[model samples]
Target: MQTQTKTQFDFIIIGAGSAGATLAARLSENPEFSVCLIEAGVKDTSPFIHIPFGLAFLARLTHLGWSHNTAPQQELNNRRLFWPRGKVLGGSSSLNAMCYIRGVAQDYQRWSDAGAKGWDWQSVLPYFIKSEKQQHGASEYHGDAGYLCVDDLRHTNPLSQSFVNAAEHVDLAQVKDFNGAEHHGLGFYQVTQINGQRCSSAKAYLSNAMARSNLTILTQAHVEKIIVEQGRATGVQLHINKKTLLLKANKEVLLCAGAINSPQLLMLSGLGPKEHLADQSIATIVDLPAVGQNLQDHLDVLVQYRCKSNVSYGLSLAAIPTYVKAAYTYTFKHKGMLSSNIAEAGGFDKTEFAGEECDIQYHFLPAILQDHGRSNALGHGYGLHVCALYPQSRGEIRLLSKDPQGELHIEPRYLSHPDDQKVAIAAVRKAREILAAEDFKPYQAREVLPGAEVQTDAQILAFIRANSQSIYHPVGTCKMGLAEDPTTVVDENLKVKGMSGLRVVDASVMPSLIGGNTNAATIMIAERAADLIKQEHSSA
Candidate 1:
């Protein structure tokens, strides 16, 4: 490895995604601390990244995405799932479906119970409020003034409303807000948007901090490994512009590289399981057995239906004129089909088999989405995505080789547990119930996926195995827990166990997956992590 001149900073953060962007921006707020943020992708300057409805186009743009695929799964008929992660300035927040959900109180309580002390709902609610800029103003559960914008969809499609009506017809309560007092109700999901545009973490937190002299942001900087010396994280080795450079961190080195990359980076730096590192010929520095275990994600299956009317967003030669008019309308007023965030409405509900908490989450898309919107289907259709919130199966991220640029092995082990399969079957039945409600009589045509013949539990299970895909919420690879726990990678303060000046402040450190989306909780993690870093420094 060719070495270039070294640069020093008080804190160095890897992966400027949802968590890193927020951490770097927050840490740089104090002029006393100099912060450096490194991103493997380029700037978030693409128009598709800024527009609320442009996620479909951004999802396929390989340059802006780290399009990683999972290892073949034995449970899913040996199928490898596609995982799209943001490689831009704002990270996945710039490429995600703008939905803003912070999950339920029980989720954080489970974390605290599992050794993530001080991360309960009450302890972390302040950080959520501190990072939010809710459009509905301040409340006991929300904030009015913050960097991240949280607002209702600018324009809701008629088909999306029909889904909401159908959900209500099936005995589900019509909730106006999902992030309110209760989470077990069907409703329209608020999103991370501002004036019909995407308000990503880079836009929310990093934009204001860019002009600050104390903060330095580097784009297209691929981090090779964390530099650990004598059981302390001292710096990071990055490959930028075809050259190797060492960046020193005087105080701390934070890993905010999400679940997949965070664990991969740790292993690359010889901080993972001893056996796994030995297999790859990498020297073990920490011998941490839980660097990439306990992988959890929302495995979703889509139940699509053909729409009788053209009200749904779908590709057709007859809709060219309509699309032209809609484009014109959006160009002037920013309100029309163009402003719709396809999956405009969704909700949470508990099944009969579920406990007091909701086990199934829904995302009603106005358009027929398949393979993460990468494939094209015929005719106009609408779809409802059903995902099991709390899965029992666990996966892992293993190093393919010692080379940092080599592909990392990601195995989600989806539907490995028998209970998860049962929940999947139940969620599909509930989705079919919602679609067959009286409110959807006018729009209902016929079920496209699974068809009407696939009714038996065995048939539904088979369909779930064939059609289920990730909803893009991967977490718990580097779990935070009690020190005595062998699977715990970090402690309650997010500091890596058996190591000093190294912490993980992202979804990877989550002891367990949240009941809802991971983005909001990730931002909250960074907010609290900033406070923890400051407290440690003040005491020193």
Candidate 2:
């Protein structure tokens, strides 16, 4: 048998996702530190990934995504939801909808209230601003000097603008910046783009940082286990080209593999639910009961409609000119419909009775989305993708087998909560009302999904149960809270409980789901975690 050589690093970051990339870039900035970042997927070099409209195309190219599907959801008419995670250098940030949202301030306050110190809105706001290079210039809430470039929607379609106008028609307040003083209202979405191209975390944070000789990035490398010694994570075992490589961590080993993979990796390395690990004949290390529990995700139901004119993404005789113009504009000026995020306009509004921040969000689309891609559309139409902001349902990610090569079992358990169903019904009704407003007269023809006949809460609920799918935001697997809380996996500082030289810094550590797109929030977590690590090191 041949033995593999072992290498070492100051910091070993698993999964080059949003959080890991940020940590790697920041931690490696100091000349004294040497960091190794490993990603399971190839480098993000696809041109489609950079194009705004090309998301629909890139989503179909399964090579770049981990297209995982959940078990049959009993509440959602037994439908399985498709969860696509980016398997590239930037992770999901490379493949996301590009909507830059900071979520409601209260969401972060809840984390501080729940024992996550220094995670309150005030403390985290600086990190949010630090991660953004807002095109709107610097302000109290936004910073001009940052890695992630945020540009307001450069080109919006007629329907998208009309939807915003209809929001005003229905008395929905409009805010200039959702990440500013308030996040409640309808407005144009700010996107993570530069020169009409998507600026994923890899592009934003790593492109320049990787130039440093201290930062080592290994793409197409999958981490198989966190080598632990007496309850301490000391290194990692990686698989590359069917060969195993042992890399030791001298300072710390960070798990930024995301919500699903992070917990799954922990379980694989004998640090999850004791009972499940025993069943798989794997020895338990930490026996964390909530390692994979507290799973949460937003499930959206697409309410589509047909239009009288050629307004949909569907190419027609009359709309060819529009498509041509859009293509030319994007090709020349890097603007136009080609630069539009399909889910261009949407907002957060609280449904009366929910105590927290807005419990529902709306994603408006100007095209008929028969499938995730526009390939299977049924003519010119529009749709509204709506879902509850907070779901009561919980699920788990357990190992399918003791084999490190096997995929983890994932059950999102969406729509299990009765309130979730009620919220969906209300959102659909609100969307209908918006479509019926006078502002929609020029664009609206008829309601296609759940049509006009499918009225009443019962029918809407049924439709929700039948069609609800994930918006691809999943978190809280490795929750962060006090040690007394058995469910908490990490402390407020992101260090794993009862473990040394290890931390889980990513979306997985979120104690509660944020109100909007989580990409920004996850990057912020990484930024703060890096600082925390530095502070601890300096003090040491």
Question: Which pairs clash in the backbone of model 1?
Answer: none
The digit string of per-residue lDDT tens for model 2 on 391-497 reads: 88888777888776576778888767777777778888777877777877876578878878899889888888877778989999999988888989999988888
Model 2, stretches more than 4 Å misplaced? 1-6, 538-540
Summed backbone clashes in each candidate are 0, 0
Give the distance in Å from residue 147's predicted Cα in candidate 1 to where it truly belongs: 0.4
lDDT of each: 0.89, 0.85
- Judging by lDDT against the true structure, name the best candidate: 1
Residue-by-residue lDDT tens digits, candidate 1, 97-205? 9899999999999999999999999999999999999999999999988899998887888878888887557877888878888767677889998877899999999
| Pairs in clash, predicted candidate 2 | none
Model 1 spans > 4 angstroms off: 1-6, 538-540
TM-scores vs. true structure, each candidate: 0.98, 0.96
